[model samples]
Target: MTTAVISDSSSLIMVGKLKRLDLLANLFQQIVIPHRVATEIQAKEDGVASLILAHPLVSIAATTRHELLALLDGTLGHGEAEAIALADEHQMILLVDEKKARKAAKNMGLKIIGLLGVLLLNHRRTHITGQDAILMLEQVKAMGFRVSARLESDFMTRLHNPITHWHSPNTLK
Candidate 1:
């Protein structure tokens, strides 16, 4: 659990909705969401019943790159822009799901992973069972996290064959 990554609001909201925020806690040493991500989640209906910030592992981080954020905000949403800036400034892996945001981060040479990637990480780490991974992936797709048909097929194939899904034992270290 030593890996710490910056997250956009979408993954937080998706995991919260799936009631699997514990996977985040179990996977990362620290789960850092940009301050803008927090605000974005709070703007949703009736204001953040999820309370992901209340968790011991989750922390709100702010980015100082105002100019970068503004530039990113031109093409991305405020939360996504701020999240990208934070991940870039800190040089941490970004947990983002949007296609455009992912593209932006990759263009900037920043590491990016989706919520489904988190699921794969968890499965690889044995934080989640293979059956649970399949179920969760379907649930995430149903929740509308932009799972392409090919990606979904790939995930299912991997989930069904756990023997090949294991990372090196040191993956957690």
Candidate 2:
């Protein structure tokens, strides 16, 4: 709970829809987000927006890296650009789901993790069992959070053999 993470809306919305937002609270001490991300979450009109805003660990923060932000704005969504800028400014890990955004964040030397990685962390932490992780993945898929067949297989492979070798399948990358 001492570690803070900058996140965009994709992971938040997807997880929130599953009634699993507490997974985030359990994982990070603070969940810092850009105002734009907050706006997007709120726009969903589900209870998630209020729940997230009410969470003690969730904080709306502004990005100070204007030059980088401006450059990112041309290609990425406002939330993504701001989240990337904020992560770069603070040198914090970013929790993002989009491939392009993840690539952009990685290119900037920012540590990034996606929604699946969050489930991986939960399983590794023993907060959820491997079977439970698989079930969660199934649920995620059912909720229309796209996961390629190969990635899901890799995730299951990792879930079953988490202790054998760490990060072998490299799905998170």
Candidate 3:
């Protein structure tokens, strides 16, 4: 069975910076984003805004879980809360980058993945070479994305050894 994925804004922006947002579309059969997330990306002028707005594989989903969104208020951004709520409603995996958002998603019993996880999946699936993944990782760091030291070490190890390392959302920090 295919894993469902709902994306928050950060991951899309990062990948769009690399001009490879298409990878997400290729890696996941479909990616859903809450309207708030789309708005967030637009507000930032992220390059992925066009892709999210126009891509056939991307869906702009509206979150119906207002109560859940209110419950998660302050702990997460509107985009994060809505993404989590949408994922919860559909039993899908969530793609979020912020540490707090990931923590909240984990606590809420949601399956989560981040940018690194997507890269790893692409590498394991042979969609991208190890070198490409490492390059993207470096770009992400350079873009000010906070990857924990442990995750950096793990990614380097995987790049060098071609061994897969699974990232638990908790271990991301």
- Considering every candidate listed, which one attains the maximal lDDT? 2
Q: Which ten residues in a row have the lowest lDDT in candidate 2?
A: 164-173
lDDT on C-alpha atoms for all candidate structures: 0.79, 0.82, 0.80
- As a TM-score, model 2 comes out at 0.91
Tens digits of per-residue lDDT, candidate 2, 110-134, equal 8887887788888887888888778
Better of 1 and 3 by lDDT: 3
Clash count for each candidate, listed in order shown: 0, 1, 0
**What is the TM-score (0 to 1) of candidate 1?**
0.87
Clashing pairs in 1: none
Q: Model 1 residue 141 lDDT?
A: 70
> How many residue pairs in model 1 have overlapping backbones?
0
Q: Would you give me the overall lDDT of model 2?
A: 0.82
lDDT of 3 by residue, 1-173 (tens): 24457999889888878888766875678888899998898887555688667777778898788899899876788899999999888888889989888888888888887888788777777789888998998997899888898878877786666555565643321
Better of 2 and 3 by TM-score: 2
